[model samples]
Target: MLTCAVPTTLGPVIGAEQGHVRAFKGVPFAMARRFAKATPPLAWTEPRRCTDYGPYAPQPGQLDQPEDSCLSLNIWTPVGADGPLPVLFFIHGGAFVTGGGADYDGTFLAAHGPAVIVTINYRLGPLGFLQLHRHGLSEADNLAISDALAALDWVHANIANFGGDPDQVTLSGQSAGASMVIALATLPQARGKFTRALALSAPGRNIMSADHADHIARRVLAELEIEQDPSAIASVPLPNLFAAVERVGRRIADETEAGTVFGPVLDGSVIPREPRDVFADGTLRDVELWLGSCRDEMVMFLKSTPPAAMIRTSERNLRVAFGDAGWERLLACYRGSVRPDENPYEALLSDAFWHRPMADLARSHAEAGGAVWLSRFDHRPALEPFLSQGPTHGADNACLWAHLPDFIDRPILKRKGGPMMPADIDVAARFQTSLLRFVTSGMPDVAEAWPRFEPHRESLAIFGQPFQVVPLNEGARSRLWAELSA
Candidate 1:
């Protein structure tokens, strides 16, 4: 066991050692109440023990109770490593309503690579994302995003003491977290803070306008039977608030076909414009980007939901994402790629909601003369017998973190969670190397040395058995997807 006095702008913090990795868990990056901007934590003269995980933000289906003080982060660094190593600043995804930094373990990445990994917890659901603008609390709107910015600012100020090169920071996230990454990349306040970014399975279209946010907020208030009084809403119990948020979220999903209920809104102040608009305006040209989605991203989420609802959701997503004509064109492009007996809605929804947007983002980056790499995670886990979800949404996360768990029960599938095959282990190692290379340098160092994503080529590095690079829209029906997007 080792300890270090890691100096911060606020003061020095004491972190414990775990083998070759020095871990600092549940380090408060900022302090904030619900619906308020996060501020720097008070300076401490005494050493603060950062050994245990912090309280998670209030979220739906959270196993543990939630807390208001959720703006914390965890750090993992090579114990004896020298200073100025690259840093991976990760954000967890739960559709903007759940998850925290504690869900991920950064030990493998920190120990194996010349990098320090930092995972952060931002506020979620109503507290973090509910647009307070129309309620006369505009300053508190997008508090979750504000929390993220505070965390990044803390890292920029204090990471050097943890042997990290703040100058080489790589901001990364999956799903709603990925959406946050994209949002940060577009925000003027976040410019020049991070060198590069990686967005995995980001649904870039979920950002709402102030009007849309107001509509949703009013609906949430009505569903909870609360007056438009912000104070009254704030005083409601978290469980009650989460229930309303979930109900409102489902209603919105059914009504508008949006990906989430609450997310970063174009609040005119914090987030001025849609992320895609920012990309189009060449605002994100400065940040190198790597982004992609899984093959069956939407299927994992839809599996448990009623099949009829899933089908309706898919159809609604197509219409909302591309309009009637565009949706028809897109459906034609994806129809042939799906298997004969399989429901084509999954493929259609995946292409329209996930892959197509990713491809468009890549194209936008390339058009802006920015450096970009596109990839598709197609590695199927051995959990098929139990989970049966195919390379589903966020599956790449397990491989990236090397925390694939053993399914203890059921004799044959026991101990068959991660690296079940030789290829699984190889993919994980290569994926880690690619991430390390991107953070350290500007490019990913895959076995084949991945190429820049351009409109004409549309080359994508596929992470799976016999990992290789291929055209993103290579298959028969998918060939026309690029045309439809154009």
Candidate 2:
């Protein structure tokens, strides 16, 4: 590892180890503007401070309402950048609503291994996604993707100065953030920018359609009372425009009963194609991949939704997502005998969506001769109310980052051994240990040989304490997928 400087572009940026962790705040990767719509990025001059993570674009009405704007990046180079280290860049997820680089602190992540950890912020909701208003740059990138690309470019061009390997960069995201990882891989622009990717609890494409994105965009516009259409609304003041967006968001949460369906548009140029299509081809062949999902993913989201509602909704979504075939296959997989009263919905949610697709992704990649790794988040929820939503989304939030939740000491995940301590040490440790190995050597630390997934062997590494291979349920999930894809 070569220790290099953090570039002159960010003049005298902060964050030198200082005993615990070296944190730099307000690092600007791209100059931001609240342009009309579809606005393109303009570069900034003057030495910008790379010393900290910057302010969150704006998010008040989303889940967990984001406690603060520590919207900053805390670099944990345990040993300082004296030696070049593999970098792990994290993208926090809040269902594309609320969350910023502020959610995570790199200190704990740095202790797990010899890696440089960087967390970043991107525009969310109306600011980041809303498809209808592009303020007018025809060929500029999708706003959210552009933000990610800008950050990647920043890391590539400048990480060397921070004693980090720009070439060995691994981008990891959760939920919608995970979708970003997958999207980034398929993006023509992200080619070779990152060496590896880790996507957890995410879906690759819109299960919905253009009409859906359009409908939502239009609805928000209308609610903003911005009398004009999407194009016309462009002239509205940024604050007014955003106010309308928030109104629609509140309506989505409080008014309408519509299920959330935010995702990247199948925009022909920037996205090119859905990540599934891209992966099917050879777009991400050169990149090492790791995919994971919790044992009860639906439960994670369910923690917010009522338990009964969780089961009811999962059942309904299964029908909607997989349709008739999915419903039938699910019946067969768990058998019609599942405890009617027990609400086996969470387990099925995990298996059908996250677990199943992730496995399928591994098989498809390996069949195409790509290197891929797989795992499951088996940690259970400690609280009874949370137990039903076993290891919910962002469950790994605590373990991946440290000193992050000051007063929110314990995460939802429960340990089998006792209270406060997670019942699943194995799951977190395996994830931590293997990630360190993967970042350093470009290969994961695993039991036996880390074999590429194949149709027959279906070699996927389960990420409990002692990582090992787990068989994939192709037959059942295959039938369900056929329905889902249909």
TM-score for every candidate vs. truth?
0.91, 0.80
lDDT of candidate 1 over 434-476, digit per residue (tens): 8888888878964356788876777889998777888776565
- List model 2 lDDT by residue over 24-75, tens digit each: 5556566554321222233444444455455665664332322133223445
| Candidate 1 collision pairs | none
Query: Where does candidate 1 stray beyond 4 Å?
Result: 63-66, 204-206, 257-259, 307-314, 320-335, 340-343, 384-387, 403-419, 446-448, 482-486
- Overall lDDT per candidate, in order of appearance: 0.78, 0.61
Q: After superposition, how far is residue 356 of candidate 2 from its true place, in Å?
A: 1.9
Model 2 collision count: 27
